[model samples]
Target: MSRLRTPASPAYLRVVRASAWYDLAVTAGFATPWTYALVHDALSSCGNALGLGALPELDLWQILFANLMGSVVVVWAVLRIVGPLPEHGLFDGIARALFATWQAYALAHGVSQLLWLFFGVEVTFGVLQLVPWRRGGNACRARMRNADHRSTGRSLT
Candidate 1:
């Protein structure tokens, strides 16, 4: 009996689309507090209240800087996801690694234990992004091999 099978979309595309959604969520989460003084102060106070220690006091410039950085991440993530380029995944993976590492270091030293949740999410998603990328690369290689065999009049099997 033959089994019915539907071809799956490329793994990298699925990953990138998911990543875009995640990035938008992160942007919304970060942008609000960084943009508003009341929210910013509340968040900073919450950190200290949670025994994570006091967050840095942000002046207007610092607040803008933080918001700007968050905006950049949002834009970059959107571009990569919309375009779904192979190299873009690698680039985002590397950036996410650095962000996760920094967050982990800070949490370990008690800089902000509250950020542990952020670190976990970032690390998890970052690794997830890379997994599909590698699979996609292998799939490409296999396709190339099959094509070469066909060109040489050899049976693909």
Candidate 2:
């Protein structure tokens, strides 16, 4: 079947939906504590919430820097959702993998049991994003190949 269609097509919409979920998660869930840590001198609780071992006292500048990092994630998510770049999925996958890896490291070191939840979600969603993109890309490529075959009466294969 032809993969060519408008953005409203099921496959394209699926990608957009997944991207939206990821962006929302980052914007709402991940950025909240960082914003709070910046607004208040509560870095310790933020660190604890992430299952990180006791964090050293954060200076005012450090808190600001942490919030800045959070802001970056928010901005990146927004841009990718609006633009919907093909490479965005790969970058998101990498980011989720890194988060999962860090959580696993923390769990192994006995940093906190709470990390397991984060780890599970990160790994699952990260892989889930990869699957849809792969399938979509494959379908598009197959359509292109079939088109070419029809035009030339010869298979590209």
Candidate 3:
């Protein structure tokens, strides 16, 4: 006698998709505010330490460039998630570079010693998240391919 197995239903898939989106949203919500606070506090402290006043009066061009850079980062992040490229593509590298730069800037500007602890944790997490793609990333690609095939009603074999 053969045992019958039931495939996941549409409702189940819906729940899974919803959960994934919810998780991503929550992560972003937390990350954005944390990042903003970290950068703002760091920059503010740096300016203060340098005797540059309460807030550094960046030129309009500088502010524009910073905004443009941030926009590029957001686009890169979205593409990294949606593109066929590995999750740890250029975006991860960019994130690592940004984190390193920020750390160096903070140190150079004499940011609060306490802030370094939070910076370290942020950098650590950023670096670790990129590891899955850096080491044996093909495994992840293969899994993604399998999922795609399954979703498209194609046989993995």
lDDT of 1 by residue, 13-63 (tens): 566567667877666444544345555566678887887666677677767
| Local distance difference test scores for all models | 0.65, 0.59, 0.48
| Model 1 TM | 0.65
Clashing pairs in 1: none
lDDT of 3 by residue, 1-157 (tens): 0110111223322322332333243234323444444555566777568665444444556455545555555554455445324433324544655766787797688654554644665465444444434544465567778989999999977
As a TM-score, model 2 comes out at: 0.54
TM-scores for all candidates: the values are 0.65, 0.54, 0.41
Model 3 is weakest, by summed lDDT over 10 consecutive residues, at 1-10
lDDT for position 107 in model 3: 69
What's the lDDT for candidate 3?
0.48
**What does candidate 2's lDDT look like per residue over 107-149, in tens digits?**
7877645456557777876775555555556654566568779
Collision count of model 3: 0
Best-fitting candidate, scored by lDDT:
1
